[model samples]
Target: MSELSIFSYLPADDPEVLEQLQDRIELVRHKLKFVELVPTVACISSLSPLKLAGGLVPELIRLAGGTPVELEDLAAADPQYIIVALEGSPLNTAMSEVETLMALPGWESLDAVKNGRIYLADGEGHFSDSPAGIVETIEMIGEILNPKQFAFGYEGEGWIKFGV
Candidate 1:
């Protein structure tokens, strides 16, 4: 199989740092040449289920340049890799989304095992002290799923883009 590339379209970050990271991330994109982009963003707290149904999810899929997996199919397929990007710290708010992801039957038992990974991108300045630690934790989760040495990656401030 080819190297799966998933892109997380997170929200606004610290304006000052975001400028630089945007350039770097674009460079990385060029280097990686990711084709299978699964674009995603952190869902804010203000959304209602009805509103999400209307256009929110669709927008994310559009941004990713791909289609969003149906909740039913997601559970049934049990993909080997998944990446989720957040606007803020995962501990603070992203966890809620994680809960939602976990609640899905497709993902409930599905886990990203070795070589499979998760990433944090386009986040605000609310991250913890050890960003590497966080990435490790995510990788560990992948290991749990696949029992292989999955590696987690993070792009600190470079992911945030202008006007986002």
Candidate 2:
């Protein structure tokens, strides 16, 4: 859809930029092909009311080699990777909120927390709905979920490992 939108509005004379975007998207897709059979991932975008991430966020997690835990069945799901990407929150602010989740019942026993797979990501900045942000967000997730396979240099800026 982002590609289609670009093609629809890009200047007719700037095929070069359009081609570049297409190439980038294709590369990301190809990388996604190598990611499969991953562990369950829990992506939370809020803490005050315990909101789960929705929209393309879950899709992106799947593409980045994660088995997204169904939001409706989260109580029964055992997540291996937990991502806290609070809407409108940067990395620092999101990091500060991890404690709230830790304090929740059964939080410390979760596989994600026990294995140190919790992460704080900059949702408002790099996890936006923009085409570029989506691509980068996928790469960042890939790096987080499958660190042995990917490293797009998004660490410390786009996301951070959280250990309680």
Best by TM-score: 2
Lowest summed-lDDT stretch of 10 residues in model 2? 1-10
Candidate 2 runs further than 4 Å off: 1-19, 32-36, 72-75
Best by lDDT: 2
Candidate lDDT scores, in order, read 0.33, 0.75
lDDT of 2 by residue, 71-128 (tens): 6334467688888898878888897776787776678678887889888999788766
Per-candidate RMSD vs. true structure?
11.4, 3.4
- Please give, for residues 27-62, the per-residue lDDT of candidate 1 as tens digits: 433433444544331222221231111123333233
Candidate 2 total steric clashes: 0
TM-score between candidate 1 and the true structure: 0.32
